[model samples]
Target: MPAVRLSDVAQDAGVSLATASRVLNGSTRVPGKAVAEKVEASALKLGYVPNAQAQALARSRSGLIGLVVHDIVDPYFATIAREVQQQVFASQSQVLFTQTDREIDTEIRALRSLIAQQVDALVLVGSHRYGNDSDAALTALLEGFARNGGRVVGMGQSLGVGRTIVPDNAAAAHELATALIVGGHRRFAVVQGIAGIPSAGDRTGGFIAALTEAGIEPELSIEVGLTRDGGHVLAQQIQEHLAAAPDDPVGESLPLCVFAPADVMALGALGELRRLGIDVPGQVAVAGFGGVPDADDANPTLTTIALPLHEMARQAVDWVLEQPDEGSAIGPEGSEGGAAHEAADTSPEGSAEETPSEVHVRGDVLLRESTALAASD
Candidate 1:
């Protein structure tokens, strides 16, 4: 038997093809209940199955979503990726997952690949290198995708052409830093991640902002990489700085604290502090962001800020699957509309409105053995 088509269903139901199409597509605007019933009955009797590809061609939607991330190895990203997969699956759509390892070239390549695959939408998580310099390239590519009827959303920090979901990095950092300060730690060391990443900047800013508000001059240090090893290096630098002036009142007697931008980095800082015979919380307090599960299991449970990575991912995927505004061109490219294009084009004034789907889940400060009041006091 030949495959049943919309035309056949419409003919059998004594309705126009357009009405039959609307009914089969589950549109609720059909004029009457009886008409909708007739169309549905005709479709069932004819064993009609909508050709998804053909439907996509007609609707300009592939029903495929793309999820692009910076690094999968990082537990934070891993947790987010898992949530994204679950959310996308529930929407009756498939996902194309890719990782860029924080490399611009890799990110560009991943974007191109997703575009070629005709994904209906995109979700970018923790992409580091997007800004005005690459705006033209990103805009052109996203516009083309939109013109082809694709949507895009962004996750994490960075001005991009989509909705964003991110942790309240700045606020969380400020809160965590304040916790250390209230604990009587007057002298502080900060371990910041890669310089250009927005998350890193936000975290560092938060730490500095807190110190500034407390009337304490911030001693800032930045690391080029975002990893445990980078934290370890900063740890060594802190030790060296202390050694150079062991007899100084601030260096010898002031409570010392280290604020690592991420939990993994905090773990590394802990390792270095231990190697140098520094007692956690007893001699120096350590704090970090992104409360991964392993943080609790660490020798000294990490005192850190908990970012709801999974929830953020789930929300991001949900936003990406949402319907685009009617009559909105995909982005000057004549493709379907995308959040990425709008984000890219958003001006400083409009940025607050067009900022990608960021769901700022409040972060809690988790106090553990790793941080405490100064032992001497």
Candidate 2:
């Protein structure tokens, strides 16, 4: 038997080859319901399989996008990837997800692989710092993609080329830190994510800014990684720090509060605190960012700033699908003013000028049993 082609399917359906192509491509602008049904029925009867590469060549689009992420196990990135997949599906495009494991070399390799595959666009979920020596290499890679008329969007932050879709980390962190301050917390401990990552820096800066606004000197503690284990280790270190402090003559317990940059870390902190017989929100308060679903179901519901992962994913796809403009060169910078720019550019037209599109869909600070007023001396 000969392999069935688009012409064969169209002839069998009594329609033009273009009609058969449009139907298989999932175009919504096809003529009418009857024509669409006929094309679909013919396709089914012939058991036709469209050659993706040939279709791409004809349309001048690969119909595929690359999604590069830091870690697949992390709930935050996992949820965002899921939403991205759905959005790509709606656009009649496929997604190729690649994890870099926070390594620059891995990220570069992933980008190169995506380019070789001829993806229509590149979506970088989370990437680490590129070295000075490797800067040219990275730039050339992105420039080549752009020069070829491909789109690239960042889910976290990118140095150059394309747009970024991210939450209001600084504002969200400020809000959560202010909550601790309002609760009368003075002595603070923080567990940071990867040292140089933009998201980590934004979160840490927000925490410091909140403490500075209150005229309280913040005690800084940084963990190497951003995982749950990182938070657990930091929690133990905080306990050790407290133990080393000289006992006050008045028996006054120091106001202790732990600010984890991510909810996974916060959960780890809670676990360590409980293991040490320390009551959460009783002896100390714990707060984190990126409200993972499991946080709400924890032994004590976590107090977290909910990042709009799904909405961010959806907006990222939209940005990639839209035509790039001169303003597309602007990438996310870890500063209050930079955040403002990102928000303005990504937002829908005629909406609040100050309201950033990335931050628009953010979830509220959910207060649960995990936090409470600081204990008195």
Candidate 3:
């Protein structure tokens, strides 16, 4: 059978083709209530599907947003993706996603494809490696995209060219380290993630600066990929370092506190340590940044900086949608749109109305048992 078209719906509803097209293609010049209802009912009866290109042409809006992330399975990105979807849906649109595996070339290709699809806006998440120079190609693409009327939003980091939600990663890590030192932690080690990735680098740098300011130096430093498997490698390195050390006369040494710049890495190290029969907090203490959900569920509860990930996601959604004051949210039917949210810090004079405003939000340091957090809050 032939596919039902707009002309067919028009004939069936006794309306002109132009009127049917206007009604079905999302044109702003809508007809009167009765005629619109008739055309809609007729289109439904005839199973006429409107062409996406035609609808976009008529409305000048595609109602689609592009979301780019490194890995959807990563809990951190996963949380942001979920929130972006809900917020996009609430605005009566759809989300198109692409994962680039943290590869620059792959990211370029994925974004080009999204532009071809004519997404109305973009939400870019994950690391912003080696500013301007390395990102030149991606930046050009984004600038062109913006010129074509599509909005750009950067979540979790600053992307120089677009509106951004920046987290105070370095500051938070510095505070966490200071607190641990005040709690009498002396011997220290650092496990760093990918060198150029901004977030991990900031955390490691901040933690080290705090120790240096307190007149102490980390005894060991290891760099690895920002992954759980990397954390396992960290555990082996720790084991080797401890094995080569001298023990005190009483056959015991001060506990070594190790800091992994990410929660996933810390949890991985913690698990591997237990597997190696190492007693946590007795011989060694571990801490991590980014308070991922799994951190609290870890055996001894991982100490971390609880970042406002949900708030960051929402702010990105709001900027891309240009609806900071629009409070509705999409959820399961019968659920209210209003729910209490984690507080976010916005630039005092910046509003979503601004084209390229930057909002900065900070995380709270939660010292848990992984660092042998005391009962005091």
Candidate 4:
């Protein structure tokens, strides 16, 4: 059987094809209420399914928001995604989400796909790779998106196209470092994630800088993959190092502290430490960032700097859906109007554009059994 077309519905309802399209697409420009009701009834009776592409072209909006995240399975991303999903649905729109596994090329592809579909807005929930060739391409893509009237918002770092909600990783790590120092932890080891990643770098940098200012140096610092296995490997290496030099002053210290800037890595380290029969806070202490839900329920209760992920998600959704200001690049439809272009006045590629308006969220430092002071203190 031939597919039912918009004209068929219009004919069935005794209305013009334009009226049927306006009714089906829910356009604000529809003519009469009675015609709309008749058109709806005819579409239902005729089993008509509107072409999304055609409707988008006619109505100048897709009512779709695209979200790009790195590793949705990670609790950090999961927490924020949940809130973003809820807020987008509440606004009578749908979400198109994808995961990029922290790969810049993969992220760029995801952005391209979303832009191809002409998503009304975009929310990117991860750190931007800055000062690199890939960043320049990403910036160009975002600038084109902005020129076409699409709104963009970022969670971890600036994407140069729109507002960004950056957590103060450096500040939070410094705070955690100071707390550890005050808790009588003079010896330290750090299990750091891949270098150049903003979140990991900032946290590690801040902690080291603070400790250095206090006249203490880390006993060991190991670079590892940003994964559980990385943390597990670091734990084993720490044990080996201690075994090889049992009487070394740093190795002899009670409650030797180890900081992993991500909770997943910390949990992995904790598991390995327990398997080795090490007494946490008695022999070694573990601390982490990202107050994922599982942290509070862990055996020793993770000490961490809890990022305001849910709140950040809420603000991101709200900001992306906000109406474009007059004379702003965004068009009436809120998307880039189906073409890729760059605004002349958009900030330099790969650099943040100073928008007077932005949403800022803070992190909280939580002390727990995993990082408690030694008995002497």
Candidate 1 weakest lDDT stretch, 10 residues: 327-336
**Candidate number of the best TM-score:** 3
Better candidate number, 2 or 3, judged by TM-score: 3
- Judging by lDDT, tell me the better candidate of 2 and 4: 4
* Cα lDDT tens digits for candidate 1, 1-377: 78888999999999999888777764445548899899989999999987766555444456678888777777777787888888888877788899987767677788988877767677787745544476477667755554443566666664355445557889988998888778777877776556457787788889889999998875546463677776677678767766775553555565467788878778887898889886777656788889887688887889989877776776666556655333222212112243222223442221122323334566888878887664563
Report lDDT (Cα) of residue 29, candidate 3: 97
The residue pairs found clashing in candidate 4 are 148-336
Could you list the CA RMSD of all candidates, in the order they appear? 6.7, 7.6, 7.8, 4.9
**Per-residue lDDT over 108-216 for candidate 3, one digit per residue giving the tens place of the 0 to 100 score:** 8998888778787888997755554648988777766664556677876677655677778889989999999998788889976575588888888899999999998
| Candidate 2 lDDT over residue span 1-377, tens digit each | 99988899999999988788877764444658899899889888999988886566555567788888888877888888988999899888899889988777777898888877878778787644544466577766765565455665676655466555656778878888887767656777776556547787788888889889988776657665687787778777867876786352224464467788878778888898889877787665788788788788876888889877777777677666653222222332211110011121253222221112232334467766677664455
Minimal lDDT window, size 10, model 4 = 330-339
Q: Across residues 283-370, which tens digit of lDDT does each residue of candidate 4 receive?
A: 7789999888888988899999999877788877766666433232321223223222234455323322324234555689899999
- CA lDDT for candidate 4: 0.78
Better of 1 and 3 by lDDT: 3
TM-score of 4: 0.83
Score candidate 2 by lDDT. Answer: 0.70
The alpha-carbon lDDT assigned to residue 238 of candidate 4 equals 77
- Model 3 misplaced regions, further than 4 Å: 131-133, 246-254, 323-355, 373-377
Candidate 2 stretches with Cα past 4 Å from truth are 1-3, 14-38, 127-132, 246-255, 323-364, 374-377
Instruction: Give the C-alpha miss distance for residue 291 in model 3, angstroms.
Output: 2.1
